[model samples]
Each structure stands twice: as structure tokens, then as C-alpha cells.
Target: MSNVFDGYERQYCELSANLTKKCTAATALNGEQKKQKVSEVKAGLDEAEALIRKMDLEARSLQPNIRAVLLAKLREYKSDLNNLKNEVKKIVSGNINPSARDELLESGMADALTASADQKTRLMTSTDRLNKTSDRVKDSRRTMLETEELGVSILHDLHSQRQSLLHAHNTLHGVDDNIGKSKKILTNISRRMNRNKWIISSIVLALVVAIALILYFKLSK
Candidate 1:
């Protein structure tokens, strides 16, 4: 989620800023420059570890929310499916009223099962993406911390911080793009479901009319 990434980005910015400040501070460290650099690096790594923990918690929270959404959708679909089955039984047994039975058979509830299946598929895809992104972020953060520990060169430290900032910026942009794609997919599915519902309604209405005419003729005889 953007929340988790934003948290990391905020820390990354703070770390980068601190690194810049320390570079200036390093110049006047006299005999303690190396010690001071190590201390700053350790502090930054600790901040990174804290950020990771926060993001991990956020990621774990997402799983339950996602599962709850999927479960709710499944429950709705199951209820709709049961209603659809009842409608089919009535149609077959000649128990359906001539008016509303056709709508039940053809409209809003007809393809509900299919939509539910699609939703499950989308949920799985989203889960996979979330996992992959989380892994990448964790790995990158670990690498950054490790790099920080490996005896920073004064010139190399500044350069690395600049690069790290740029990397973090680009990574956050990628996360934004991914979230956008997920949103787009969900929107398209919603539109498709609306169209399907309209079509199903018309078909059901026609079926209901035909049943009504047949019943009226039989009754007149």
C-alpha cells in the first residue's frame, strides 16, 4: 500500500538529509571522523529497521482486510446463487409467476456467479502483487543497511546517499504506478458488470412476457 511506502519514503528522506548533514560534520571530526560516520550510519540503519517493522505490520493488516472483502463478496455471491437456483426450479416446475420470474432468470442475478469468480481471480492477483512488492522492499532495505555498514568512504558516502535518494524516489513512483493499474482493473470490471446486468434484465423481461402470454391463452381455453 502507498501508506507503507510513504512511511519508508519519509524515513529515506530523513536519512538522506542526515547523511548530508553528517558529511559536513565529518569534515571537522579531526581524529573521530570515522567513529562519527559509523555512529551516524548506525542511527540511520536503526531508523530503517523501525520503518521495516512498521511496514511489516501494515502488510500483515492488509491480508485480513483482503480476506474479509473476499469473504463478504463470496457470501453475497452464494446468496445470489441460491436465489438463482430457486428461480430455475420454479421455471422448470411451472411454479413461477408470469411476471417477475423472467427477471430473476435473466437479469441482475443471472451472471452473479461468474462475476464472483472473476472477483476471486482479481483478489488473488492483487495478493500476489502485494507480496512481491513487500519482498522487494524488504530486500532493498536490508541491502541498504548492509551497504551502510561497510566502511563508508567520505566521497563515496555522499555519492551513495544521493544515489539512494534517487533510487527510493524511483521505487516509490513504481509503487504508485502499480496501485494505479490495480485500480484501473477494478474499475473496468465494475463497468463490465453494469453492462451485463442491463443485458440480463432485458432478457429476463422478455422471457417473463412470453410465459405470461402462454399462461393467459391456456387459462382462456
Candidate 2:
């Protein structure tokens, strides 16, 4: 009958709309919205099943071609419902949505990249500080070396001055010894001249006394 066919078409259109809503709910809806959508989908599926059963009973009274088309549509709808049920099961089992998973991955990768860049910056700063410390050490070593060289030069100058002072001291000691010997020689010459003068005066006095005694004896005779 025309009314029976029209009822079947309307039921098919309703079931298709319910399937679209269920798919959208499974993929897009969340929280209370998702729960409400799932309840609606389950009720729709039950109604569709009931409608199919009624159509199947009436289908036997139709033409063979009409019955075949209805049977095919029923089988297709049943298959789709079974597949959607499996999809819901997977969703309930905690399978992550692809879009959400991609977003989380991108955020994690950005954090990792930022952490790596900070580590690199810290390493470079440490390296620069180490280089500065090394340069300071090198400058200190060079300054120490220069100081050592200066110490050696001062020691050499001190040694030369000490040698010159020793030579001058030896020369002064030699001059003092020569002057002491010259003074002793002058004292010996003055004592010899005084002894010679005393001998000459004694000889002159003895000669004058002998001549006076000889003249007195002649006068007495």
C-alpha cells in the first residue's frame, strides 16, 4: 500500500538523521552534552529497530521487488547501527580523539623546545664564564712570570754592587798598610841623626882639655 511505503520512507529518513546526530555526538560532544546525546541516540536506535520489525512483517504482503528493496535497506541500516555501536564502545574505552591528541602533542613539543633552548643558553653562559676565568688565570701567570724576572734582575744588580764594595774595601786596606810602613821608616831616620850629633860633640870637648894641660906643664918647667 502507498501508506505503508510512505511510512517506511519516513522511518528511514528519521533513522538516517539519528545516525548523523550519533556520529556527531560521539566525535564532537563532551561532558553532559555527550551524555544527553548518547541517551537520545540509544532511544533512536531502539525505535528504529522496532520500526524495522514492523516493516519486516508488512514487507511479506508487498510485491517481490518492493520486499527486496526494503530488506536491503533494513540490512544496511542494521549494519550501520552495529558499526556505530562498536564506535561508541571504542570511544567509551578511552580512545583519544585525533584532534585533541595532536594539540597536546604540539604543546608538549613546544615546551620541550623551550626547555632545550634554555639549557643551551645556560651552557653557553657557563662556557663564557669559564673562558673569562681562564683568561684571568693566564694574565695572573704572566704577571707572576714578569715579577720573577724582575726579582732575578734585582738580585743580579745587588750581587754586582756587593762585588764592587768588596773591591773598594780591599783597595782601602792596602793604602792604609802602605801609609803605616812609610811612617815607621821616617821615625828610624830621625833617631840616627840625633846619635851622630852626640858623638861629634864629645870628641870636640876631649881635644880642647888635652891642649890646655900640655901648655900648663911647659910653663911650670
Candidate 3:
């Protein structure tokens, strides 16, 4: 930016220097040379004035601080142009027209100010857009974090449910083992009861037979 502005400043300086040289020569020369020098000075002044307006327009695109500095420089260039115009006026008609110069200065300053205002408005609009974009990014990031937390919670719930299912399975397995042991114990008790019943029946039959034999022997005696 500075390079471009510096180029323009250098060009304006060269034009101003050339115009000054022409205005100075117009005073010391004869008929044709003096007229030619005056003509060159007028042409140079027009060119320098156009360049100043161009620089003013260019400054509107610069940073506000930089534009302010450029504007100050532009005003100084305008002053230089005014001085050159006065010199040319003296050379041609030996008169100074302050009114025309004043009107032109006021108009240029007004245009420059308008351009600066427009630049400020554009800068503010751009800043607003950037801030909105930043907010949207923050919202997106927060949503992602919330989603991640929800996913973690769901995984934890699944793990707990899995553990509960495993515990229930283990409890059912223990119950089945206890039922098998109880069935085995009942089968052993039934076998012991059948053996005792047969023993009691055999003992009762033997006693009855022995008592009958004793009665028969006593009758024979």
C-alpha cells in the first residue's frame, strides 16, 4: 500500500517540480518562449490537479489512519497547486482570482470527506459480518460438545445394563445348581425309607412264627 502511495507521491512531486520550472521560465523569456512555457505550465497544472483527485479517491480504500495521513498530504499538494496556479495567473494576466481557487478547494475537500465517510461505513459493515460469523462458529462448536457428552452418557448406560444382565444370568445359574442338589438328596431319602419298611415286616413275621411253635410243643407235652 505504501509502495503504491509512494509511487503516486513521487509522480505528483515530479509534476509539481516541472510546473514550477515552467512558471519560473515564463517570466524571464521572450515572446514565443514565454508563451510556450506558460502553455506547458497550464497543461502541467491540469495534470497535477487530476492526479491529486485520483490520490484522494485512492485514499478512501486505505486504513482510516493511513487515509488521514494521505488526506493531509493531499491538502498540502492542493496548496502547492494553488500556489502554482497563482504564479501562472500572474504570468498571463498579472491578476489573482482567489474566488475560483476557493470554490475548487472547497469542492475537493467536500468530495474527499464524503469518500472517507463511505470507507468508514464499509469498514463497520465488514466488522459486523465477521463478528456474526464468529458467533455462528462458536455455536457450532458448543453443539458438537453437547452431542459428544450425550454419546458418552448413552455408552455408560449401555455398560450398566450389560452388567445387570450378566448378574441376573449368574443368579439363575446358582438357583439351577441348588435345585439339582435338592433333587439328589430327595432320591437318597426315598431309598432309605424303602429299606426300613422291609426290615420291620420281616421282624414281625418271625415273631408270629416263633409264638405258634411254642404253643404246639406245650400241647404235645
Candidate 4:
């Protein structure tokens, strides 16, 4: 079964190569020869297209798993066939020389193929930038989350410290009240000591004067 498909592929390749040669030879041809070559290439094209259809049908007869790979190859052949058709079309329409025709076709094909590659490259670049942006956004969000957590912790510690400070302030206020009461007691004691000293000094002076008068009177008598 696979051998049959292989045979078809081989035939198609040979025919395609021959058609390419004919198309090339047609560029140097003129008069009836060019028309004859073009007609022959057209007939070959139709036959090649028929082979492709046959290959398609044969690939379908294959096992489901094998069919996929063969189908893929068939698609490539189909594309190749289309490209050949375009070449013949160019040869027919432009009636230009071979070398110029090749260059023109190559230039056009290059532009088409290059456009696809350029688009892919641009898409990859955009995707890379988007991925980087996503990473940066994730990092920023994580940082913000950590900062928020740290802020909450710091606030909690500050609140605890404030409570401790309030407790200490209350304790110090009680001590200050005790100190004030003690200071007032000391002031009252100091005032009483000063008054007692003045009273004792006056009593001592009065005793001395009374004794001196008694002594003077006794001596005179």
C-alpha cells in the first residue's frame, strides 16, 4: 500500500522536473515551439494534478495514523504544483526572457515569504515584551504584598509599644503624687523647726537678765 503511494510520488517528481525544464526551454523558444512547449506543460500540469488527487485518495485508504503523515506530504506536493503553475503562468503572460523571468519570480516569491517571516519575528518580539511585562507586574505585586504585610506588622508593634508606654506613664504618675506629698510634709517640718528655735532663744535671754539683777542688788547691799 505504501509502495503504491511511493510510486505515485516518484512519477509526480519526474513530471514536475520535466515541466520545469520545458518552462525554462520555452523562454528561449519562439514561433510555434514556445506555443507547443506551453501546451505540453499545460497537459503535464493536468496530469500532475490528477496524480495529486490519486495520492490523496490513496492516503485516505491508509491507516488513520499513517494517513496524517502522508496527507501532510501530499499537501506539500500540492503547494509545489501550485508554484509550478504560477511559473508557467508567468512564462505565458510576460513572454519575457528566461533570466529576467526567474529574477522577477524570485523577487516576488521572496517578498511573499519574507513578509511571513517578518510577521512571525514581530509576533515573537511582542510576546517577549508582554511576558517581561507580566513578570515585572507579578514582581511588583509581590513586593506590594510584602510591603503591606511588613507595614501591618510595624503598626502592630508600634501599637504594642504605645500601650507599654502608657502603662509606664501611669506608674510614673503615681510615683509623682507620692513625691509631692512627701515634699509638703518636709516643708511643714522645716517651718516648725525654725519657730521652735526662735522661742527657745528668747526664753534663754530672759533668764540671763533676771539673774544679773539679783546679783547686782546683793553685792551693793
Highest lDDT against the true fold, candidate: 4
lDDT of every model, 2 decimals: 0.58, 0.67, 0.75, 0.80
Better of 1 and 4 by TM-score: 4
Give the clashing residue pairs of candidate 3, or none. none
* Cα shift from native, residue 201, model 2 (Å): 4.8
lDDT (C-alpha) at residue 113 in model 1: 42
For model 1, what is the C-alpha lDDT against the true structure?
0.58
lDDT comparison, 1 vs 4, better candidate: 4
lDDT of 3: 0.75
Q: Which digits, one per residue and each the tens of the lDDT, describe model 3 over residues 1-106?
A: 3445655666777677666656655655657887888888888888888888888888877999999988997898898789878767776873435675455446
The residue-by-residue lDDT of candidate 1 on 1-221, one tens digit each, is 44454445345444434433443343334445646664665565456446555644554466676646544534443353344334334433444454554454344332444444554665565567678888999999999887877646656888989999999999999999999999999999999999999999999999999999999999999
TM-score of each: 0.29, 0.41, 0.43, 0.45
Top model number, TM-score: 4
Candidate 2 segments exceeding 4 Å error:
1-112, 200-221
lDDT of 2 by residue, 51-155 (tens): 767777777678998788767766765775576566555555557778864554464355345545544664465556567877988999999999999999999
Number of clashing pairs per prediction, in order? 1, 0, 0, 0
In the range 1-221, model 4's lDDT, one tens digit per residue, is: 26567668767766776776677677667778989999999999999999999999999999999899889988988987898799789778856766786776565456445544544664565556567877988999999999999999999999999999999999999999999999999999999999989988999998899899999999999
- Which residue pairs in model 1 clash with each other? 107-200
lDDT of 2: 0.67
Which stretches of candidate 1 lie above 4 Å from their native place?
Answer: 1-155
lDDT of 1 at 167: 100
